[model samples]
Target: LLYALLHLSGFEDVSMEEVKNFRQWGSKTPGHPEFGHTAGVDATTGPLGQGISTATGFAQAERFLAAKYNREGFNIFDHYTYVICGDGDLMEGVSSEAASYAGLQKLDK
Candidate 1:
């Protein structure tokens, strides 16, 4: 999936060669993505529940910006934050904390 996303994004460092060399020494693509090292990744993420925690903050920021900027017919900051989690991710305490925070804040977006 990362290879496909890199392919679609056409990120400069993620060449076809880079895709083939993914996870190898010195390759731009690592086993886990490194944000800022890559152009397309929004946040540094891994297999754990970190993605949920990061995404909660990201979505809250988006919501705040949307509320602050968007006028009746002049929408500016509009996009849905998407997260896909596995059973392991959900089992993590950070994920539960993030979920509870989202619920408490009513972060519907």
Candidate 2:
């Protein structure tokens, strides 16, 4: 569903057939989404809180880059980081810690 959504939303790299073959051996889709391994997967998310935590890190990096390089009128680093997490993710301690840090940094995503 997530991959489908991404594809429908214009992420052309997302393959529906790969997602259909999810978890199968030798398939592009794995048991969990791997960032570089999968075409459109943004993060590895086998563990409950891993995705959110990784997204927080990505958001921090974006903020740092924007602060260091973005000009007043020419916004070079103007991307947003988004994360989708479930109840299990919210229950994890790692998620709590990551969320706290993101909140402190004022990460909108």
Candidate 3:
């Protein structure tokens, strides 16, 4: 469903055909997202909370880079990290810890 939505929303990296072949060998779609394996996949999320944790890490890195390089009127590293998580992800200790750190670091944006 997520892939379908992304494709419908004009995310060229995702395709309905790939969604159909999901979990098949040599297919762009996999059981879990693999960053380098697929063009639009930013992180590998085989584990329940891995996506949330990885998103937090990406947000933190963006924040750090922005702080170091952003100018008063030029926000070079300005971007948003969007994460889709479920109750299972919230149940994980790693997700809790990563969420806490993201909150503390003001990475909500």
Candidate 4:
């Protein structure tokens, strides 16, 4: 699946390296969430709420990047985040914590 995505996204133009040979850390493609892990995946999310937390961080980062990069003419950072919380996610304490914070921050859309 990863190989297919890389190829579809024009990564073939850059390099055709295998993932296992990729370094453990500090490599562009780390074993996990190295930001440099892949061209697309913004953050490595394996844990229950890690993805949600990273998503919240990305939302915050987008706000900062928009201010830094997008001018009045370009509102590129305008977006929304949709999280589908299942029974499992609701049962997780981390998800509960994140949801509480989001509610306190009035982040509902």
- What is the Å distance of residue 62 in model 2 from its true position? 0.6
Give the alpha-carbon lDDT of every model. Answer: 0.83, 0.81, 0.83, 0.58
Residue 15 accuracy (lDDT) in model 1: 84
lDDT of predicted model 4 = 0.58
Error of 3 at 103 (Å): 1.6
Query: Which residue pairs does candidate 4 place in steric collision?
Result: none
Residue 85: error of model 4 in Å? 6.0
The reply for model 3, stretches above 4 Å from the true place, is none
Ordered from best to worst TM-score, the candidate numbers read 3, 2, 1, 4
Q: Write the per-residue lDDT of candidate 4 for residues 9-64, one digit (tens) a residue.
A: 77742244544445545444543443545675555556566666555656666667
RMSD of each: 2.2, 1.8, 1.7, 5.4
Model 1 vs truth, CA RMSD:
2.2
Segments of candidate 1 deviating more than 4 angstroms: none
lDDT of 2 by residue, 1-109 (tens): 6676666777656567766877789877676777787566777788899888999999999889998999999899999888888899999999999999999989984
1-109 in candidate 1: lDDT tens per residue? Answer: 6655767777787788888888899887886778887667677777699989988998899899998999999889888777766789999999999999999988888
Clashing pairs in 3: none
The TM-score measured for candidate 4 stands at 0.50
